[model samples]
Target: MEGKESKTACSEGFSSIRLCVFLLALLALIVLAQLAQAGISRIWAVDDGEKVKRIDNNHPLATSSDNPVRDGSEVSLFGAKNEVSANEDGRFVVLPVENPRYRGNELFRAFENYYSPRVRELRNRYGLDAVVAGETDEWKRILLLRHWIKSSIAIDNENPTKTRGDTFAILDAALREGKFHCTHFSIVQHAVLNSFGYVTRRLGCGPGLKEDGGHHGVNEVWVNKFRKWVLIDAKYDVHFEKNQMPLSALDIRDEIWRDGAQSVVCVVGPDRHPMKPDSETGKSETRPDTYRWCSWETSTNRFTTFPATSTSTLIMLQDEIFKKNTWYRDGKPHWAYGTPYMILTTRRDWIEWTPNVITSKVTIEDTKARVFLSSCTPNFRSFQTKAGDDTWRDCSEEVELPLAKKGRNCFTFRTINLFGVAGPEHRVEIVYSLDKSEPTTPGTLFSESFDDGKLLNRGWYDGDVFNISADEAYLGVGCIEYPWEKGHTKPSGCSGVRHLFEPTEEVYLRCYIKLSPGWGWTNRTYHPHLMHFLTTENGKYHGPAASHLTLYVEPVNGKLRLAATDIQNKNAPHGLTQGPLRGGYNGKLYDSKEVLFDDSKWYCVEAMFKLNSLDVKNKRPNADGQLRGWFDGKLVIERTDIIFRSADFPGMKINQFLLTPYFGSGLLPHSQTLWIDELAVGTKRVGSVSPPDSSAASATSWGLMLERINQHFPFTFNGAADSAIVYANLKELTSP
Candidate 1:
């Protein structure tokens, strides 16, 4: 059915491609000096180094036939050597002997072929070389170099493959792949500059460990014109859009010298600890000490050692492993959390798989108790659980499915326990066989049907239908009457679970939504209560009415925008009575921009509300005021701060929240409703919202995020919080 809509949303927008755009922009702004022969280029001597006077005769630096190349002067400092090659032209590029290999390094080849080509093209087109000429020669070079590197590569922690010996291979793969770690970029860029006859070396440092323990590396280039090593970080260029420093920005106190390539830092020795397990149980009388390799700051070139154990993610891997069990069993893992521990824990939903159902017998077992659990409607072949308890017992009831209409079957833990101790306990398994002969559906739908009872078979379908998606729990129903349409007054008729959020802290309710076909609307006399399931009893005291955040779903700029106000605060202005409006603490909308929403795509929408206003430091919020939103991944509105109290600007606190379908007039209806997943509410302000991970997006930028978050540390050690000390230290410097 056609529905009335607002004016179409404006399309003028600027999308952000962090890694790609940054790299391109950086490349465009580089200033490579092109000095003609005989030009007098300025070369400065270091505090402790000697300078040489050369004859500047007009000629091409590359093809100066008359000038004899002489070893005029050299300076050594740190662990690198800086040498300026007097090109035919008086101007020169710095050549720092960085590693064992001279000039031609693996990284050098990748840059010349892949990165430099694009950079040269961009530089020529932008004319940036001219814009940066007179800007404090040192400052200009630094700025240019910083921009080039920051935008060129995306930073990552772990490389896909295990290879790590050569920087060039790593950089080449990363640049080609559009993502890499800082170390990889440094290696590659060093090699490329070397190939260009420019000297390059590694200036590595770490956190005040030994010289090598610092674990930091940046490239140094010696420009004959400058007579010093211009420090540049190829890694920073590869991973970021804003380089931290420039080439001419010198911070070294002493002269710098380059050494053949060596590890930035490596801890050679091992530390041993007494072998003490939480439980003391060993058959042998002689118990050996346990030793785990940890990073250290040693005196060698490799100072700050980063243990492989600390860098890889074990959590995500464990999560993948957990999903395998689910897919292998009931077609999905029944994931939930335990209270206290579970309530405070973060939830990670795994990628959903297409289902292929085959004939199978179900089994139940409690691994913790080492016993098989009982079922309610269990058939030797098929059934679901409805009872609560111990022992491996199949339900007395038996059921069967038609050979046709075999969809992936899933189970929900209703009366089952996750811990196998208290509450309801149950563990179920299915056994079936896969049939490759069957064709798969081309959408997120059921794929195959297994008729055997040996191994569980699973397959998937793909489609664009938003009704069924990878992130949904497929609930099936036979030819029963539409429960809501049949006027079923039971709470279960609404089906959707009511989640009551009691303020561990105050929260804001924001979401992107669409309604089901024929979903009813509300009139003045009738309004549906926003249900809050606060108790596990299912039939216990329902939360009080009027405490929920009142919401009305309506069309705003051709998209569904949920307009909510601070209804919990009784002191604010009342809301408009008609056209999808509800009462709450109203604030001025002096300037309201259009809201963006995707037709079928998921939009990342966020809302933040102040929880208090009375206490200055930690005051109770008057109303949730700051209302902002995004569509796809672009910010659409910067709503005027929702001021609750007229006296204090933008004064308001938030309480109670809700998400429900429209209860107003049904005249302006939507053709297809929306499905929502990944709903988050926070009291803290959300700055940039990341788009959902999809294959269509560039994976290189993922490297940048990986480098920043260092998610690897948490995932590697399971429950051990100490796996990521490096990340922990790094995060401290940039903590918000």
Candidate 2:
């Protein structure tokens, strides 16, 4: 629901001229540089914590007299490469030199210092309070801060008439005009957060391994509970969609920090120089004569450069925050420098998994365990990590979360049962872990249901997080309810009466299926349909129904293919498939291959449509020339022509589709599976797919220019303004 608003008209095309120009400029600049090398050189630190007194009296590392000196000796810091001086007061002094080589460090520092007083003043005048309220949790607070920063700063549209000045003036103009660059966005965000008493600092920017070669910006904030600074990328937020992620989440972080975390960096065209060389540091890479510290984060940062939404930007932002301190730092951590290469390193720290205080009483009976425990908090972003694997999976929930105990609220463990307790006299074991990763196919941790006696809703015991349901369940990119609730429609465009249910010990192999025989207008009856069942256990795929259970049903085929064989328990990690399925069968109603339906009497159906020939192009008509309709043991209709086919995703090739309608239950008295015979299969694929009829004459296929102009206005007037009407009548360029 939140991601639906992000759909926008796709842009037409790209410009090769612009790309060529950018590449040429970058090549020229890199060629101009005297040093062309790779790998880490030496690291130099300028730790301000160990304050320096003064700079060397005689110019040694210093190239300018304007450089600040303290204690008559120089010092080094973590990020900045410039020489530092210690004053007589036992405090280190580093003069803000002009045109520094690595502009990111100085710009970040200037941004913080220059705007601190202004930020304070604005807060007092507007009573906006902290950008993020203290009462909010760390993740929420960070999210709020991100939203404020991203929404407030506008992209800088450089006007031909305006003269560029200092970062402050430029940022102010951009903010006033509702336009800002990347650095401007970062600077504003940092200053604003600092004013709110947030521990914030800027990361480095420069060329990256990605296609784009422009200035990048990353930052950090101290998470209270973690008591550590987390990395952030303000530019990524501005560039990409803050809602729907277009690129990989971690890729955005690598663009800013460039520690091999991301594979690519999305950036706008044209190369920009790094910080100008300070008169002090004699190290000159790119000459200062042609370079200017243009805050380009506005149009060409990782997030903004990509065609993404605000939520996607938020996902990337979260990833960036976590990427910091992923690795350890060695020696005097050299401050990252250079135009496009800002080296970043960190030490990995241990993460804690605080267990839920509410104890769950799980009855482990016959290898089956049922636990009803409500976790105090449902950390929305904090997910479960499966044992043995370095990935995180999704879980179902009932309420809004990020579950840490809230005030006056008690957690009630909602009971959602799981079946199939295998392994004779087994011992139940469950562990919990949490981390971050891409969200993928998520399932539960059970084997089979006793009532259905068929495996439908199976789960896995991944030692990390389990897919515990508070209420909702997974359905594609969104979630759906178990039973069809009022107004709860099936996935859009899905045909037939879809009865999706979670089978339990009481309702095993039970469904409402019926059929009608003799084609054409049957006067009183209709065609036939069937329901199939498939089974899975522990998040992995097992063979067809492995249990030898008795079934009772009205005969459809010869005698219902009631008994099954070749049932096996598969434990291979890759073969497991989880979902609404029980067993497999040949549910054929079309073609001259299978004669499943016999008498005209009503009968139950259960079978799997082995999706073999899904070729959209090979659509051929049957004998009657009425589009193929395999139902009630007959090919009722077939068509000679098809509307359209998707050229992009051609691999809809299915493996083995199955179905088996059943009767009679293992424990429940009312449970009964009916005869399964005329199982039908056609060209339709499960889940959402393009319409089968996308012909040129179709309304959807027609090009529509739903264009609008100035749809809303503050004022309405005819002709000209009242005051300007008189002047317009006499004015004709004064005819001079």
Candidate 3:
């Protein structure tokens, strides 16, 4: 499974001064070793022995001009603040004489202390296709670098006896031990940006609102383009932003204090906790309320500046670097120039929704609907809208309108960019007039999506197991979260959404899902089933299984694969006692290796289970029962001549649609999460793509922004040889 790698080693303590000296020496040795293998003459990216193909023949990077004279008109286009310029393709170059107020090189060495071999080797293994992971644009490259470094290290809470405050020593010690915490996280980010000639500072977040009582740590970096200091929470791997542009601590405090949640646009990472367990299921899936204790996502009471940022500096520098933007007009540096604060105003655009299904905009005769949100410049980072009286979240791309809310419902959404700039508010009104609706016919059923931030108000219910979540989703707005304990192993970890289906000769169902990366390996049984159905004796809610069918995903030979199963025996239901689950791999498991399932990507999984004749006397009813599966619109698994049920017991109808999308137990080594969307079942086949393609996953302006961002930061190594290496040990994308 593609997940965070757990790696840590106990560290031996050292005095701050001694640790700094030792780490610098070690870095020098590593540099010397590389020079020995290649040479100082070659401006290479890594010590890979092969001569890098330089982008430009004439020394690729721009050399410092001999005269070092400033051009008056050049400042607006070329960045030469503090004697620096965009030398070539967004890379920075410094003039001969360093600015008296800057300590760029000194900070560079500090970054070297933490850029260990493990970092480089990982980049090499992944090869050139890692720029998307690192990025090319200097500012966003920092974001990607921040994400990769943090994602590589899992949280290790074992308190160390002696933790160094010096940025270089702290980062070295953290990397050497492969352990991470709030401080270590900040150090890694600080080191990387610091190495890249960006002035970065470390700080501590207060325990409460008092800066002096800080318990958590964060970092800040000076973005030359935006010409501002941006606040980044390395622990959460997120940064605050407004209007899609990044924001600083003072900016965040002032805007939030002034405008409250409206000033805050969106978080760049998973900065919120999963929803609280709404109801209860008598299973391991019931998470303790303590799960809500996700401190990283919560608002910091106080933002405290770390003393190391000041004391660790190599020279006595002016504090102006933290405040002013450098503007050169008429061949002179203008340090006092101010840029107007950017804010989004009112937006004028309309959205489209499906009329056939339930939508916030229209009263639907059907169970589902899709809506389209307006676009933005740097593009929509997320949305902030109400669900319940108070439920609001930074929603992603597609939002499923709440059908349960009758009449007209209003929702305000805005577009956000990486710079933390949020665009104008686009208020949308969903009109659901229940009076004007079409009647339903036979061979039809309903669908449910928590996109509206409400539970199923229709026939389906949580059955006391799942909680509605806004953080994760495959499509539309929301999906019910299948929460479970940290280390409990029981079949109870399954999703709690339940619906007793009326009997039909054949029922076809399909749902989009984003699987947990740690699912397959964390599950003891190599195979794990998610959606299962059985015949309820009372035809209501109770778990009575005379027959059953299931669809799930699993790992086969290290690659994720889709699979299915069934227990068609009599009332005993193939010796069923263990919560309606029959023999493991009862028949030939249904799966296709040609199209492996990806945990990180969304897939439309569907299954068609047809019932056998009730008159069949034999246990293995051959002719009538059948099963077929489709993945992402492609047919993968099929079984004809199967016994899904028997005659004597006569519970032929498929009753309970157990909304369980989970592994066997809750005792998982790693906590994982997934999302299910567009879940529906009817007598006819429902392929991955509906007629006219009702997919909300179509590309958008935000998608375009991310595309350009990825292009500039392609997930591949672009041989843009930096003078030396910074920690390249990066993110583990998707499954192996």
The TM-score values for the models, in the order shown, are 0.24, 0.21, 0.38
lDDT (Cα, tens digit) per residue for candidate 1, span 1-736: 1222212211222223343344333322221111111121222111112222344333232123332323222211111122222222211111111111111111111112223333344345444355445554432344354454445556654443434535334534544655655455555555444332333444333222122121344555544333333545554331111132212212221111112112111111011122222332221101111100011111111111211222211111122122222211122221221222111101111101001111112332321111122222101122234333523332323332211111112222212112111112222212111221322222211211112211112211111111223222111100011122223332222223223333323343333343232233332233333212111211222332222233333334434243443233343343321122245233122112553432323344444333223334543334434445454445554444343322222332333233332223343222223344333344543322233232222211111111111111111212223213322432332221
Superposing every Cα of model 3 onto the true structure, what RMSD results?
32.4
After the best TM-score superposition of candidate 3, give how far the Cα of residue 247 lies from its true spot, in angstroms: 22
Question: Tens digit of lDDT per residue, candidate 2, span 422-463?
Answer: 101101122111111111112211111111111223221111
Best by TM-score: 3
Query: How much does each candidate deviate from the true structure in C-alpha RMSD?
Result: 38.5, 37.4, 32.4
Return the top candidate by lDDT.
Answer: 3
- What does the lDDT come to for candidate 3? 0.42
Against the unseen true structure, what C-alpha lDDT does each candidate score?
0.28, 0.27, 0.42
Each candidate's number of clashing pairs is: 86, 111, 46
